[model samples]
Target: MSDPIAARPAQDRAGIRVICNDHSGRNSREAEAIDLAMKVLGPQAELCHVKGSDITETARAAVRDGYATVVAAGGDGTIMAVASALNGTDCTLGMLPLGTFNFFARGYDIPEDPEGAARVIAAGHAQTIDLGAVNGRLFLNNASIGVYPAILKERETVYRRWGRRRIAAHWSVLKTFWRFRRPLKVEIEVEGQRRRFRTPLVFAARSAFQLEHFGLQGADCIRDGGFSVFVTPDVGRLGLLSDALRLAVKQMRLGEDFELICADRLVIHTKRKRQLVACDGEKFLMDGPLEFTMVRDAFRIFTPPPGDEAAA
Candidate 1:
């Protein structure tokens, strides 16, 4: 197998490149975060304000421009887009976590606030981490299909109407459930074994910290070099709502509410030719038969050192 780590760029020439999307998740504060990052990283660092669709290409351009470190300064979606391009490439990844959830950045012990996160990047402590991929696209937190993607669609609408806030995100979930009607019939294959499931959602999780934070099980499986797959039983709308409530309260039961499948790789097939998939809080339509896999030590990320008081 080819080595996952790419050769680092020459230190003397390569510099830091920070990418931000003001329109991502909660748009208003992204500008402030970008300004703070630039101030912290100094004038030599390059700042690129990119649109959502152009994030990956911009990160690629940063790599081609010989940047040593490319920082994503928005939410999980921005981080995922930048990582999709920089993963297995010469540039190191950094984060500013300027979003509502900021799961990907928090998972790496990066600070949620912009200034603290920027200092972590300035410290330049690099580490290699595993990344999950579905259909050849990388995701830092988790990916899901079925009701979750529908919820993301609703969330976007809600963000536009109510502005971006945690309450708005939760409200969107409630709205999606009230209108939820369909369950997916999928064939999931893992480790040469195949099984069928009728479920409202199939969630594949890559970040153990996210699962643990939500009071969910399967983190250990993720730490063991595999991703955890959660399939919600084909519960009717009311039952699904009940599960959502349980999850919100961190009282969700494992076997009773959802089935958990732990594997290094898996393939999911649906009857539909195309399905909406949500990855790291971004939704998109993808062709069927989604394959999910994990690449261990694949991406180099900038993180704070152990017990770093300044970053904390």
Candidate 2:
């Protein structure tokens, strides 16, 4: 595809700012590409590095500084933080995928390479997308409780010891599953319909691509509005392990292994006063009765036009 920014005048690309996470994958390499891209774009195109904790405030400051576009250069967590800050704003959010999965970026067809994604940002095509929220905390991907959050907690420890690789992530999952063998008893309300469940996990997905990836149907249910909630029925450890294996191989069937529900507003209640919830790979200890809602066209994002592959 032709370069979008190349067709536009140089002055039009000047009002862009890039906020990069220093801890993202291969930070040095990402920084080099981003810096080079900024120089190519124009003198007014600014780049700044920020710690993960400061991404939200830094993005808000960029908006306050009158930047027309703010690019998030990191993983899903970094992107979500910046998105939370830019929610309901006119400023466009640009993605420079530098994470392990880059689910949100890939779903939107954003390039994985820093330089290629940078070119798309320079091209400046923007689209409106939905946002998911859990108890006021916004997320770009999905949120979950039970086994999902437990796996993330274990993944951090394994990541620290073995480095962040796919093998280490899988190892973490095995260890978490072996350690946490009990199912959680909970009540869930979806679109005013209530059901109680004894399950190993419950996942609420906003990204249709992610839902399709797991082989769990119902992407169309959430395409218009609402979330696709996945609940794993009461199963033994061996059964749970079998389900995990199916998910790994992309062979999971919803009715046999889990249940899928579609709802605009969901309320989850657990015995504990506070629970650890995982949202887009980040874990948070939030108070119960967890409330989830979907907001349509909450923000604008710069993405590659449909069917346009990243430049090699």
Candidate 3:
């Protein structure tokens, strides 16, 4: 079947609305990039600087106001927020990638440099892309339960206390690992097969770029329009730490510490009625059993043409 997300011809750049998050990254360059983007997009484009909470409503308002393209100028979380509002809509989504790690933007081949990304937006080519949903909440990158969310919580606390830095992130990791020792007992149903696992993490990935970013060899699964479910086995602290190190170094073999399952849909059941889930860096306490589904070609995203590295 022909991919529904195949590239479309460039659209008019006159009616573009950019929804920017004020708190994306610590670097002054992001602010400069936003300014540069506004200049590149010209007077016709509408730029709205918003707090994290207002992203969705602002994007939706843009759509209601009939914008040809609604640009998300922030990180994965910011993009995902705007995406949740724009998914299944006809409006094209543009990305500025003004974050520490722009997994979605970079994965889609959007340039890391703000000026370069702005140029791509001005050019105005768009392609449809898939999104993953957990309990009906959309995610552009991936969703996870277990140690990941704990780590994120700690990372936020540490970031606030010590200011954001690489060492703070590492310290958060150590703190989370030391404090969280309980593994989740989950019953996962996929492809008509039922299996139970005692594990520390369950990851549902929608972006091939994220898989490749982690040096995992399964981008094809994402391209096939399914969730690549990664489950960490019931490894102890030392084992978990070792596997994490291997993953960091890109040497963690699949089927060893982690089991990968590709599925169009999955059911993850746990004893608790509500559990914390991390979706593209946002935290939610959602009710289980969590139903995960792949929404193929759910988002129409602006990008430079394929093979156009110079634009990137």
Residue 298's lDDT in candidate 2? 77
- For every candidate, C-alpha RMSD to the true structure in Å: 2.2, 5.5, 4.0
Q: Candidate 2: TM-score? A: 0.90
**Which runs of model 2 end up more than 4 angstroms from their true locations?**
1-14, 26-28, 307-312
User: What would the per-residue lDDT of candidate 2 be over residues 262-298, giving only the tens digit for each residue?
Assistant: 8888999999899889999999999999999877777
How many clashing residue pairs appear in each of the predictions shown? 0, 1, 0
Model 3 segments more than 4 A misplaced: 1-14, 162-167
For model 1, the stretches where C-alpha displacement exceeds 4 angstroms are 1-13, 25-30
User: How do the residues 178-254 of candidate 3 rate in per-residue lDDT, one tens digit apiece?
Assistant: 67788999999987788999999999988898788779866788888888889988878888777767877889788
What is the per-residue lDDT of model 1 for residues 215-254, given as tens digits with 9 covering 90 to 100?
A: 9999999989888999989888889888889989999898
**Model 1 Cα displacement at 110 (Å)?**
0.8
Candidate 2 RMSD to the real structure: 5.5
In model 3, what are the clashing residue pairs, if there are any? none
